[model samples]
Target: MLIKHLIGAAVALALGANTVMAAGFASLGEGLTPLGGEKSGNQAGTIPAWNGGITQPPAGYQGSGKPHVDPFAADKPLFTITKANLDQYRAHLTPGQIALFDTYPATYQMPVYVTRRSGSAPQWVYDNTRKNALSAKLADGGNGFTEAYGGIPFPMPKTGVEAVWNHIARYRGEYVVRRASEVAVQRNGSFSPITSQQEAMFKFYDPKGAYADLNNVLFYYLSFIKSPARLAGSAVLVHETLDQVQEPRQAWAYNAGQRRVRRAPSLAYDTPIPAADGLRTADDTDMFNGSPDRYEWKLVGKREIYIPYNNYRVSSPDVTYKQLLQAGHLNPAYTRHELHRVWVVEGTLKSSARHVYSRRTLYLDEDSWQAAVVDQYDGRGELWRVSLAYLKNYYELPTTWSALDVFHDLQARRYHVQNLVNEEGGTIDFSQAPPEDSEFKPAALRRRGLR
Candidate 1:
């Protein structure tokens, strides 16, 4: 199997093709797992092989809207990593994670759990991923992809940008409606939640849709603020474009005070996300999003690291936000970490590009294409922020996605949290009926704001 992969890589290089093809296994479920991870486990046998993942909901799973039951509820932590024994586990930790211990020695700790490779998607997604591995190619210089829809565009990624594209185009669901809250925790651990209702249609992943139907649009999203009188009534609409270099992302903002929807040109790149208080950027919303043209990406290969995984406890309704949110980071008691293989991709900002982050490193899970951890650096070659995705498989949708995305600022002694639906009734509804195209337009933003 190893020789087959080497021969395939050699053939690709000899052909001198511009299309970045997978180094091994032309199709899925061969030398690769269904979603393109290594089919076999490591030599140590700590991380188990992908055994068809969580295809069905476990016992006591009510539905999509209710809290999901943790399948590993009976499992306990194998060991814990703390400042006291940081050196012992230094080989399996990221620099940003090690910095966390240094920043808050007393409260920071990681409860390592047994690795359960519970990442799976719908059967159709697996089918599409196999087809994509043979045909999909990068377009617009890594800013967009072609001949790919409904699944990961680069499952057996060959380049750094290809790995990032897999994360960008990975299937979440056809459509989803989620009501969640955002909070920018202050240095003193005080926070005022900015709750909002969000709806999105992944046009690229629509079962009935085709590449031509996309019309260069990736997804349509509309977010309406629903809390704290002063911040309520405001809304934002976005048309995420695939080829961002040729056609940048289109965004609009509806201000309650002005009662008008205006084009938001400064909503991309290093633009600060609203309500995040400069703790996160617009592109930093989903670990990383938008264009990859600003930076030169390099595939740094794979490494085994301890990352947050199967984190159902942190987002459980039984655990309130007060208990979860702490000073330097989220409370470690509710979090779960496991060792898994991750593709390390580094993006260095181009000389011509002007952005806040000079360098960015993404840790992409091998099983799912999700970017589980990200380390962002500033111009002075200093680590500025670290982002973590608490990934859990939504058994109903059968997709692995983040329950909560946390960004910690090492310098400011603050952090920003997104997608906090622990207290919300409906949680995340992946079965949402596909919304009309008009509902995501700028005109709709004004109409909804007026109502």
Candidate 2:
């Protein structure tokens, strides 16, 4: 079986040769045609972006087909990063970055296959649905099916995982079956259920098993584009789950001007992130508070996915967009139209990558692409930290991604929680608005009490 899978993978590699080379430097803007902006085409008169083979219409008009198309349309990604290209791309990464990808291929290299669905909602919507389904599955016990190397139990129940996997598989199957059916119907003007054989062809193959060598290729590709920058004034709170009551645990980003990590403001139920300089402090209490200074961050990617908010799905009809966005729970502009493919990253302390728990692994959902789940280990390589993000859905947004996220730290028995829902009477619009620069600043930490 493995041999057959390998042979099939080799064929795929051969077929994807051009795509692999194209992807190797796609970040360099080679062979792509730009669109929807002032500069739409390249010097050779070809579009600067990949338009999925759709031709643009006259000025001020949208494409007759679909306005929103898959960015990776036309060509499929070939061989993901493996030992073969590790050295080739290693020069472009930091040592910590290198170790992050090298740690796990099974969880990271899971191939995200795209099925072209016509009359489908925008790519962002599909992206959200996929993520939401995955989250729902995890919450229900999908995490239990597979265990990590160190006997770390999966988080969810078998039933939940099966249900969620079925949902995801069905969605993917429908897209694939529908596309094939559409093509056939287009030619013959008739319709029928997809054949079992056809379905088998798509379902039987495992991208992870076949392409194990190419794990983490997507991260490398994303790094080539725009990497995540640290939010200068952003304040983040890591909620620790002790025996019982959730307290106003604190940590703050250091505002260099004030030269301190002061005690951040205690967040109300839900508050809009204030402007960057609304509060500034030079005291450790104001910044980091009393928390240990043993963590780091990196922006992977952004996409729309569901989160837990207000005890139910915020994106559902019962809730209003006005309430969610005002309280800093939802940002329609950044998440609404985004089909984010997130980064699979790791975080470790400054002391050493070889701490008692050598490393920590994080899987960040692309849409509302926050770090949703974290897997940590102890110095003896035993699984120690299991953090889960309970997300709330933000309805008014185009995607069903989360607006509020609560992190559960299993080992430390604490919780790190961050909620972006709007505060009452906050003057932010739910419509398309860019994220404020201050929202990510260190000073904002002191004001929000999220440090």
Candidate 3:
């Protein structure tokens, strides 16, 4: 019998609570979803049970290397929530959502669709998750984790940091290559798209590898600008470490104008993303990423909220950017919101730490551990930014990920959206052979740039 106090003994001692629990394969697939969510639906029966979520592609899907076809295309919105109806749905909406209604009373709204439990992973991933449930443990004061690989590390997390770790280490396939664009939409809705080709090798989820083989590196990422002649040929490479406190993330950038490659140490934490126009920080990349050492995480329990889910329309090749991007946010006509149970985790900056966001509340989907919505606060403890991840299951890979990520600056009245591939010939490709480790080296980055 293996038992561990999730969030670590130090946190439990400080919080003065005994949260120790036993973990094994017995609870998985029995009392909990394969990935650790509640197996049953909500009391209202709006959200359905996890009946082995979309393990196969829809009938109309053309297969890999194509845009995913919406399985719920025939479903209609149950209702819409605008500024006028906001009060009625206030209990189901996040504070950031309410602020959006107040910020753009006329345009910003939520088109609530039927909830679909379409989050899933392969059978092997489920098996690995069960293994991780028994082995994974927090390391170096919640900065990272150890003794887990190939699946979610903390399937049945007992603390906020453990839940956050699950989000950071969720299964994202072994290798993938995607071509997408990012745009920082201004107040008037005018913007220039910054397109790029990105690739990632999830070493932590490598099917052929084990925990002992990780060597602290979780994944390798490389991105090169593809369009807007001025930024073309520029590239960035990153070696994301699992234990960041022990070894910070190693990053390198290739500047096309300078024709030189240099180490990029400013790619972590609160550093403002170059093309983001200061709307998002570097750690805000995948909803939330990097180290968790700067903040105190608290598990605020669960809530049934309307979060963006199964949003195939927003990622459709048929929807043009001009028609999708509105002045305040993405056109509500294409966004799909559904009511589902989510785990709410809050991160508050430690009094001694320094960062732009003083506090952040993250709502993660119970089934997938994906951050669906995040409300960020400034130093004055005022709402400053809101981030949403439009989630959809890539049925072919049998995994759910964000089709588009939108970061809104409530104060500036502008937003930035990324991972737009509506016009791209192909989307994410997980079938590609994994690239050599050398490809992520600084020398390779310089070589790829010169080409």
Name the runs in model 3 displaced over 4 angstroms. Answer: 1-25
RMSD of each: 6.6, 23.8, 6.0
Q: How far is candidate 3 from the true structure (C-alpha RMSD, Å)?
A: 6.0
Tell me how far the alpha carbon of residue 282 in candidate 1 is from the true structure, in angstroms, after superposition. Answer: 1.3
* Ten contiguous residues with the weakest lDDT in model 1: 1-10
Off by over 4 Å in 2: 1-19, 23-357, 366-369, 390-401, 411-416, 420-451
Q: What local distance difference test score does each model get?
A: 0.84, 0.25, 0.85
Error of 2 at 244 (Å): 36
Clashing pairs in model 1?
none
286-317: candidate 2 lDDT, tens digit per residue: 11111122333332322222212112232223
Estimate, for each residue in 1-451, the C-alpha lDDT of model 3 and write its tens digit.
0000000001211122234444334568887888988889988999888888887898888877688889999999999999998889999999998999999999998999988999999999999887777677788988988777898888877789999998999878889988898889999999888888888999998888999998999999888887888778777888888988899888887888888888775567887886788788888888999899999999898899999999999979999999999998999999999998999999999999999999999999999999999999999999999999999998887898999999999999999998998988868888888978888788888888787
